[model samples]
Target: MTLSLYNTMTRTTSEFKPLVEGKVGIYLCGATVQGAPHIGHIRSGVNFDILRRWLTHLGYDVTFIRNVTDIDDKILHKAVHENIPWWEVAMKYEKAFAWAYETLNVQSPTYEPRATGHITQMVELMQTLIDNGSAYAPGNGDVYLDVRALKSYLTLSNQKLDDLQSTGDSEDSFKKDPRDFALWKAAKPGDPSWPTPWGAGRPGWHLECSAMAHAYLGAEFDIHGGGLDLIFPHHENEIAQSESAGWGFAKVWMHNAWVTTSGEKMSKSLGNSLLVSEIVKKVRPIELRWYLGSAHYRSMVEFSFEALEENSINFRRIEGFLIRASEILQRTPDISISEKFAAAMNDDLAVPTALADISDLVREGNSAITAGDNQSLGTIAAQVRGALYILGCDPFDSVFASGAGSNSSAMDGLVSLALAQREAARARKDFAAADAIRDQILELGIIIEDTPAGPRWTLAR
Candidate 1:
């Protein structure tokens, strides 16, 4: 099946055709760097990481851009509250986010640009908008986008001009129209400022994405992605600003749904936000990634402790099958995923369906094992591993191998020694000794299974 994605702008599922053949450019709205990443923030990372992986699997050279808003009102506020420099606050949280992403095995983007580093590009973009009359800089170093000048100002948000509320980004006195949003903010006392054509101020939240995306992905890119909550003023303003400057902007606007708690958006203010660091303590990083990426990207995930535990158990089942199959085959073999799995992924990244296919394959693999069909077991295991690889959850993938809840090398050696003793006892026909050794291994949280190949052991889930 050909790749198709839901474009937020047109409100329909459309076939994906890249601007440049065999090369796909994606711009994802990354974290704001005000605090440590929560599941809500990292959901976007995991969702887009899956998309990037799938595209790479399809032989596309993907240039993925996920930006960081290192300078923002939230960062400044946190700095003041914590009695530290704003840049320090941004850097600290930025490192935390990077750590979380790496721990979860989310692949690094081709370019991860920070908003503060691209001030010159933003200034040039503002100057272009000002020259084109779509932007005006008040003498006070504040610049506002002329929303009325754009023909389809709220097309992306699907809202009328008068029906929209003020962005509250800047004081209303500086804006010519109440609906107009700030492209740049004038400097205030104690606030971090940069020299620009307008004045020594900073970039607005919306303007930074537009400027940085243009700087890296060029005038037009294949896909622009972020959380659904950004569809309104953030993405809407980007369309108005970039199009007014005669750039094609993003071809497809993809927005992932939020991770909610108690029917409300997961947020720190609500006291329901689950930090990635906090959750990883309960479950391994690979399990956490599976839980986050299990749902369809466009569907809302109501966060719950029960659901997380359940998902973790289900992932272990898949892992258990791979371990048993590897033991039977004596090695990890190459894989060819089912066609149904590929079709599901190509259909707007229907991950839930793709995962269902994986579950079916696991069932078949287990059945083959029970039937003592080693050949069938190896084939099914390869298919399951292949599918997991596409989803970034493969057990043997180096990323997961380093951090998963697997036994350490020393533990492996110790288990092997115990198994060798058990083997000697069985060879001597001493059933009592072999049973005692098996019981001891079970007490140590290892499950030893007698198979046609040999005695196989795995850490009990």
Candidate 2:
């Protein structure tokens, strides 16, 4: 089957035909970089990362651009509140985003653009709009896009021009219509401002993306993506600005649903919004990725601590199968993975279904091992690894690749200390001391089975 994607632009699923024959261009809207990224951010990144991997698997060179909005109101507010510089705030959160992405196994974007660094390109685009009579600047140095000028201003949003609600201070008097959003905001005292044609000012929230996307990806791109929450005002305004600027804008618009807590929207008001760091401390990282990736891309993901604990448990079963399979490989290894899972992945990147098939293969591999069929077991294990790797859920990967896992160095040191105590007791003919060491190891949430084969260890169940 040809790769088919549900395009929000067309409101339908269609076979994906790239602009270039063997290449894909994807632009995903990244975060504002004001805070540590939560699961809401992870949902979009993981959902699209799987898609990018699938496209690459099918022999498409994907140039994915996920931009960072570093110069937004939130970043400014955070800088003033924390008594830190605005750039410092952006850098701190950007680092946090990178840390979260690595732990969650979300594949990095091909080009990660920061909005602040692209001011020249933004100014040039605003100049183009001004020359084209689609935008104007007031006496106060504030620039606004004239909504009445564009023929297709509201086409992407599907909202009537007049029937729109917006919040701004100079909105009512400056705008010919309330729906006409800002292209640029004039500089305020002590605010981070760039020198522009409209005096010293900063680009608006919506205009920054338009400028960045056009500057890097040209007037048009193959795929544009982000959270469903950005569908209104943000992305819609991007389309208007680009399309009105005489560029084709984006061909396809893809959005991933939010991660909610307890069937309610995760918000500061609800006091239930959990950070990625807090959640990762409680659960394994890859298991958290699995929970976010279980549902279809457009479906809302309900998250909770209890759900994550179950996901972590389920992941262990897969990991245990991999550990056993690895031993089978060590003995006699001539295994080739099946491409049937690839076929499923090509069907719009159906990860959950592919994962289910991998589980079935694990079951088959286990039964075959029981029947002394090592060859079949190794082959199935190879295929399972291939599928899981594409899904970013490789079970063989160390759970604590980063410091995010429950397996801390402190805990490991304690385990080794207990083991050393046991050895010391054995040397001194102190069986009681050795037994006490063994008990101490158990108390630290580790199982130590002293087999005749040698000492063996695993995390406690």
Candidate 3:
């Protein structure tokens, strides 16, 4: 069956046809790099990573572009608050975001262009809009998209132009309409500025994405993705600025739902945000990725410590089955994603359904183990591993085994030595010593399970 995806633009699930057959170009609105990344911020990364993986699995040469807005109002505010240069703030948080993405095993994009790095592109785009009468630069060095000039200004957002509130990006006195969003902001005292035809100023949040997308992906791209919250001013403004300059912009729009907490959107202001760094310390990073990516892309995930722990346990069950099956087979099975799992993935990335299919296979593998059916175990293990590989959760994959499972090789070596000691104590009928060793291991947040084959060790939630 052909892959189908929900296009936020069409408001329907449609067959995915790339602009260039066998090649998919995807532009994802990436981090602004104002501060450390929260799980909410990384959700888009994981969701799109799965989409890119699935496309590649189907033989598409995916050129994924996830841009970083390294210069923005938030970065400047953070710099002033911390008494440092704005670039310092951007670099600090950019490194944090990079670490978070790596920890979650989100594959690196084909190109990660920084907004600050593409000021020339942004200027050229603005000049095109100005030449076409779709934008105007005030004497103040601030340029604004002429919302009234574009009949399709609100097409992506599906809202009447007048009904939208002012972008509040600039003073009302300088705007043709209060809703006209800024394409460029005039240089402010002590703010990071770039030289442009209009003046020395910085690129607006929305303009950066359009310019970066065009610079890398060209006039039109296959898929544009981000959090659903960007539907309004951010994405809407992108549509206006790009289309007004005669570019087709993104052909398909895909949005992942937010990660919320306590029935409210998760944000730094809520005081309920969970940073990726903090959560990785709680559960293995692979387990965290499973928990985040298990939900359907378009569905909101309610962030809860309890739910995260439960999901981690469920993932361990699957991982445990794979480990046991590998031992029995005497080799790691190659992933051959099952038809059912592929069908679900093809149908707009129904990850929840795909994961359920994985669970069913695990159950079948367990039953085969109980019945001593080696043939069935081998087959089931391969299917399970294939499905996990598509989801980027395969335990045997070196990516997760090396990075997510443990902190360092030295720590792993220490744990291995301790596990061996515990096993030796058990072999010698030293029940008290074994129990004490187990307790010590548990205190270190490591789980040791005794099975017929051997004692298995994993990080505990």
Candidate 4:
């Protein structure tokens, strides 16, 4: 089936056609990395990761580029607070982000360029704009894009020109127009500085993606995505600068909605934002990822302990099936993945529906287990795994090795030890000890539930 995506630029769901016949180039806006990432950070990554995985599965040579805005006002502020250099701050969090992404199983992009690393590309792009009259250096040694010179400046957003704030004009001391945003900022005291024909300064927030995307993915690309919060001013300015400067920019634009907390927006002020590391300690990393990948990409998802709790429960249900099937089916049969699952995913990455499909397969697999039909269960399990590759859900893993409850245990030993402890805890009327052992089991990404047949545990893939 041909994939279809909802283009934010055209505001329509159209069948995806790669600019190059068999290759797809995608540039997704990555986290600024000024602080530890939150659950909200993974939604866009998870959605686009699925897009890349599905396209690759369908025989497309996908080149994915996710840029890191390592040089930003926030990074500078953080550096000053810690009494460290700005580069140190950026590097610290960049490593943290990579660890979190690995934990969530989001695929690494083909090119993950840092804004500071691509200064030359940014300078060249800005020079092209100035030479073409779409941008200018207005005597302050800083560069700004001229909004008035570009006919399609605000076309992507369709926001009225009068509605934009004339407020951000520190560069060139008030660019040609109030809405004309900065392309480069002249260096100030105690901030990171770089050499450029525009003088000693740094790249602006919007300039990095335009430069990096052009540098890595060519003039035009297949898909561009980020959080919905960036559609305005950020991506809109990208469209203005790239199109005005003659790079074709992107054909399809996609944005995932924000994650709300307790019926309010998740923000620093509320002090309710759950960092990825903190939540990883509470539940399995896969559970945290499942919550992010559980909903429709375009829908505004709420974040709460209750929601995560519910997600944790649902993830355990699916983990239960994968575990039981692994034990009951010693000789698995060759399986063909279902096309209906593919169709659901191809439709704008309709993940909620895809998740429902996975649930359906789990129910069928469970029934097969009851009837001792290993062949049917193995076939369905294979299909479920193919679907989960798109979801970044690791349903069953053979090497839940390192982060398991303990370090020094053979596969047979870990399973046997856990079961023996469970029986011992149950006989001693030691419910607290029993619960502690259960948590120990979960830390290994293995879930145990007491059943009428007997106490059973499943490895969370």
Best-fitting candidate, measured by lDDT?
A: 1
Residue 453 displacement in candidate 4 (angstroms): 9.5
Error of 2 at 78 (Å): 1.4
Best by TM-score: 1
Rate residue 270 of model 4 by lDDT: 79
Question: For all candidates, what are the clash counts?
Answer: 0, 0, 1, 4
Model 2 scores a TM of 0.87
TM-score of each: 0.94, 0.87, 0.91, 0.88
Report the C-alpha lDDT of model 1 over 1-461, residue by residue, as the tens digit: 78999999999998999999999999999999998999989999999999999999888999999999999888899999999999999999999999999988899999999999999999999999999899998788899999888877888888888886656665588778878888999999999899987789999999999999999999999999999989987999999999998999999999999999889998888887799999999888888899999899999999998999999999999988887788667787566778989999999999999998999999998999889888989888888888888777888877777433357889989988999999999999999999999999999888998877688777665
* Candidate that beats the other on lDDT, 3 or 4, i.e. the better one: 3
- Segments in model 3 whose C-alpha atoms lie over 4 Å from true places: 166-170, 402-461
Looking at model 3, the pairs that clash are 335-386
Q: Native-vs-model 3 lDDT?
A: 0.89
Worst 10 residues of 3 by lDDT: 399-408
Residue 122's lDDT within candidate 4 is 88
Would you list the rank order by lDDT, best first?
1, 3, 4, 2
Q: Model 1 clash pairs?
A: none
lDDT of each: 0.90, 0.80, 0.89, 0.81
The Cα RMSD in angstroms, rounded to one decimal, for candidate 2 relative to the true structure is 4.6
Alpha-carbon lDDT of model 1: 0.90
